[model samples]
Target: MSHILLCFTCFESFRLTARNRAVRLSSVGKIAEKPVIGILGGIGSGKSTIAAEFAKLGCKVIDADKIAHELLEEPPVRKKVVSLFGQAVLDSSGKIDRRKIAEVVFADDRMLASLNRIIHPLVLKRTQELIEQYRRQNQVKAIVLDMPLLVEVGWHKRCDKLIFVDCEQKIRQERAEKMGFDKKQIKIRENFQISLDNKASLADNTIENNSDFSAIAKQVTGIFSYIVDNG
Candidate 1:
């Protein structure tokens, strides 16, 4: 496994702090009326799985990457992307070639910033709309923000509680490899965002995901119950 995976050495500190915060929240009987939860984890740490578990418990999930993909399909957005990156970034069908875009942006900071400038605002607006829509619904137990760069983009500040999904470094690298991401590719993508240590430090809860689905599910269920009961 790459050393990059093991670089987040502050997990124990954050884990303890998060537990204390949870205890304080429980003792004070203070919780978000309709909690907006943010998930933080390293690549392939199963953050989506964690969000899915929350969904099963009645939380509405706002997937920023999915929204960004939808935005990329808009004609206006396509035109802007074409203007910024030129026609070479588009496929034969004229859709934005995300792989090509990633190759371009991930290799250069300025290009990535330019791309973010075009896509982020639109995604944020749509996310807010969905959040408000879900918030008004009586059955929604919580709102989960499943954004890849949640903390890097400052969306973590908007969350009522942040959950860090912890998995062993070796397991995370293997998972990312199974997803067609090589170690170098994973490192490059992660480099653009906030560190795992920082993300964990901001978390109010930690869910260990180094095991099977049942284990993760039980932990997520417990966290969901805790948030609903006391946050």
Candidate 2:
């Protein structure tokens, strides 16, 4: 519930502009033909749940954090990680242990930056590949990118449209508490990313997720309808 789930600044760390929703590809790789909608929000704001809604509505969803986890397991990536962090970051099986890496990075900015440098590019490469694949298939209706640090890391610039999930701080704090985060812990996590207001300002559309699941669903469906119709 911290701006991202910890260990995933791989523990660190959109808005749409324009009337067409998301037709342009500005990421500098092969242009994706379909709309790429980026989801933005603070930790505990139910961003993943929103992504799932889009998936259920038939969008091809890609989670950067999940992709990063896979990158850490690649043999070549492991070799580099070990070279950079030394063997202490590895588990008994010689794989890069995320918990061990997090312990080191969360307490040291330099290590965190180094770890991000090691993993982020690999994740972005895979992410872009997926985007191209989906674009090429012509079967997928939409592409939803659920990246926790999308804005902080500048991925927002590639998105055709971005949706910011806004929820009241008191409510978000309570949700974080239910997920085992105390107030101070929530603050620590939130501090790692751009402010919610800033995120909202950058988004093309904003959804207020201050209520129940059904209401959230309705809101998501509304936006989904817009994107499909507009795009």
- How well does candidate 1 score on lDDT at residue 165? 93
Please identify model 1 stretches exceeding 4 Å from their true place: 1-30
Write down the lDDT of every candidate, Cα atoms only: 0.79, 0.77
Which candidate gets the maximum TM-score versus the true structure? 1
Which residue window of length 10 is worst by lDDT in model 1?
A: 3-12
- Per-residue lDDT of model 1, residues 1-231, tens digit only: 221121111111222345544554455355567889999998989998899999999999998778888788899998999999999988898788887777787787777778777887788889999999999999999999988777666566677788999988899999888876787888887776667886788787899998889999999999889888875
Choose the strongest candidate by lDDT: 1
> How do the residues 1-231 of candidate 2 rate in per-residue lDDT, one tens digit apiece?
223354345333233344222333434244245788899998778888899999888789998878877778888888888998898877887777776676677678787788788887778889999998888776788899999888777777788788999988788788778876677667766766777877787787888889889999999899988877766
What is the TM-score of each predicted model, taking all chains together? Answer: 0.86, 0.82
> What's the CA error at residue 97 for candidate 1, in Å?
0.9
Q: Residue 112 in model 1: shift from native, Å? A: 0.8
